[model samples]
Target: MANKNVIWCDEKTLQKDISGKIYVVTGANSGVGLETSKQLIKQGGHVIMACRRVDAGEEEAKAFGDLKGSYEVMKVDFADLQSVRNFAAKFKAKYDRLDGLMCNAGALFSGDQAQYTKDGIEMSIGVSYFGHFLLTELLLEQLKKSAPARVGILSSVGHAGNAKNRYKVHFEDINWKNRKYNGVDAYCEAKVAVNLYAMELGERLKGTGVSTASVHPGWARSNFGGSGVMMKVLRVFLYPFRNSITNSNEESAQTSLHVLLSEDAPQHSGAYFSQHSVLYRDKECRKGGWPMTSPNPHAKDMEAAHQLVKLSRQMVAL
Candidate 1:
């Protein structure tokens, strides 16, 4: 369930001394990313909005009113593993430290047929899970140096009570060759992976002061999900309902920002937050048993996320 007061903060709410602190937000050209970046800029923080669209990204940067805070746009195509590595390397070489990383970009219920990323993985799997996983791994050092850094993975509430996901933990065929592809299912599974990755990364980054947590942004009425006819029709009928059912992007984004900036949750690693507070991680995840309902419940299966990392390494040839 979503908290009634999930959105406790607004653009004028917190004055984070981000003037010197550097942060990177992906999919920053629109929706929640844009709002989050705007809020940060309003507080005098330096933000790098990474988006696949250069023109849109620059337009977003220009909207900050003043480029004085070092607001800039960076290129990042999440579906491309090489692009993910390029993004991290580019960031590391230019900045001394990074204070926060909000994995704002996501692949939502796209109705498009199952497609592989440049790396040959399913589109949703590549963009939503593998891409962010690599970015976080490559940027781990700077995040640690900025001690007590926050790594927030934007998850979804739809992850609960869902099993029509077309495919199981087909760890063997992550690309989904044998099973039919369901865009919503893929998105849900990817979100589940996002939570698992957070837990896995928490263990690997222990003692580094880099906190990790999964956050549900609440159903955001944003421009995502583009699969095909069936999806298109569903979206049309769901539009009116969606508007009322989901919170605005900015409103939904508050939960993610809270996890990243809240002093109260400094030690909230490996936890999942819905709205502004931690919620139950499904009975299975809590009991050390695989959430049969979740596509991938084993948080320790970081090996899958790592495979993307390996592909990134090979792409960057690092």
Candidate 2:
């Protein structure tokens, strides 16, 4: 069981000088992804900001003028499978090694409308899980060549079934084609898939010197989940409690930084982490208080993770 009193270390305390390492951070235009890129640059690492909007990414990269390392903005629209392939091809063409890959881009639609990507897959699953699955698969060789590399998948606590509407990956109806659609459920299911992908990938890359981990960044003050009118109204009502309930983007990004660059990450490959600590089962957590660091049973089910990997490969036509 993880200690309830565990405190996350400040990002500034990281002293690992990653001077020549190269990293890729998706959705680096804003929020946690942007902050993560900044921290990596501060530690003397080159970063590729994989974004959907090249113009926005270029503008955002300018803010890092004083940073020690270099940065490049690459276009990658996760909603389109072709765009993902293009990004990977371009990256492989330019870079010889990839020290780290952060699957940080994600979205949540509030309304009941069903949205599909250019690939004709559910928008949430397509972008949050399938797109990342394809991207990581394409980059596996580079990561292995780099050796001792890391992949961090940004998941969410909602995957733990703690939300008002619980969710689990419906293998038979992954895209919600057969059943009624709920955007929140679809988002949670996609996150579950992301975590499972990390688990299965970690196992497959056991001896390749490349490691993977899934992380819950906690509720952060970001533009995520604000796409719908309902979400906007809720945000307005919850504005007063935002400071108390949500973490700053920088703070939310620490777990990802720890998993990607910390010396301790290798030993915990395939693990799920929150607040810079390994998550345990809910029953193993402290009795009285809510176990923020504990992962739900679904996240730890190896059987389900394996199944998800097989299904994902087929879905992406890999």
Candidate 3:
């Protein structure tokens, strides 16, 4: 059955001329973020490329050739809370209206040894969830002021966990201080928390004209896993069938573009939009056609959602 709500948001469908709109795309130098930024700029939307490495962002922007819109690079290390604060302040000082914010930066460490951000939070949660939490809080007023603005969270299907093990955020030991650490599990926890946050945020922002949604861009081919030995080996091993297992950056980016640009997006605030990978992992992940999908059971627990938001506020001092 086809999903009528699934609007294949490609260049052809996204025909709106957003000449003066401004968007912020974190991790804009590569992967889905890069493609999202590229497509937005091509459609006359100004993008603030928020990256950890400004130089890399500058390089990518330069290679983008001539665009209908414009872009500028800004530095932000999601692992550092202070850096997030600084970035928010800088963004607010320069731009009055933020048309959209794409929380696309993520961190995935390898091995059982736990990694910590500069702020002493677990690295995966810090970068993938908390930093965005704080950044959104700081800029929320601006989003509200902009009216009709949007916030797109780039989450993952890993949050759903598997039949054998359902993922949960360990509120008591979120930093993995007591239990043996697993980076993959930590990533799952962060992603689930992100969905919960989006749900809570959407509820709170109702009628504020600032809607939010969590989207899975499929298993996109991106520089997510750092250049580690395991990644190198996995890349080589999967090279032959990569097209079947993973999505191209552009294909994955459609979900982001949908939440950011689609007129129908606001109606589905707090929803989770997914891709072909959700139905058939063996099929090639193509661009667009994001049908609404169920997330982890935890994502729909209003108590958990509210609790997470409360904890996040306390952690970020919002």
Best model number under TM-score: 3
| Top-scoring candidate (lDDT) | 3
The sequence of per-residue lDDT tens digits that candidate 3 reaches over residues 131-218 is 9999988989889989899998877777777656668778898889999999999998898888888889999999999999988887
Backbone clashes under 3 angstroms, per model: 3, 0, 0
| Candidates ranked, most accurate by lDDT first | 3, 2, 1
In terms of lDDT, which candidate is stronger, 2 or 3?
A: 3
Per residue, candidate 1 scores C-alpha lDDT tens digits across 175-288 of 668767777777767776777777667767788888887777665656655456776786778776554455677776776676666775456676666652222234333211
What is the C-alpha local distance difference test score of each model?
0.69, 0.81, 0.84
- TM per candidate: 0.80, 0.89, 0.92
Put down candidate 2 lDDT per residue, 126-199, tens digits, no spaces: 89999999999999999999999999998876676753444567899887888888887888888888877888
Q: In model 1, what is the error at residue 264, expressed in angstroms?
A: 1.8
Candidate 2 least-lDDT 10 residues: 285-294
Better candidate number, 1 or 2, judged by lDDT? 2
Q: Model 3 clash tally?
A: 0
For model 1, the local distance difference test gives: 0.69
Give the TM-score (vs. native) of candidate 2: 0.89
Q: Residue 147: error of model 1 in Å?
A: 0.8
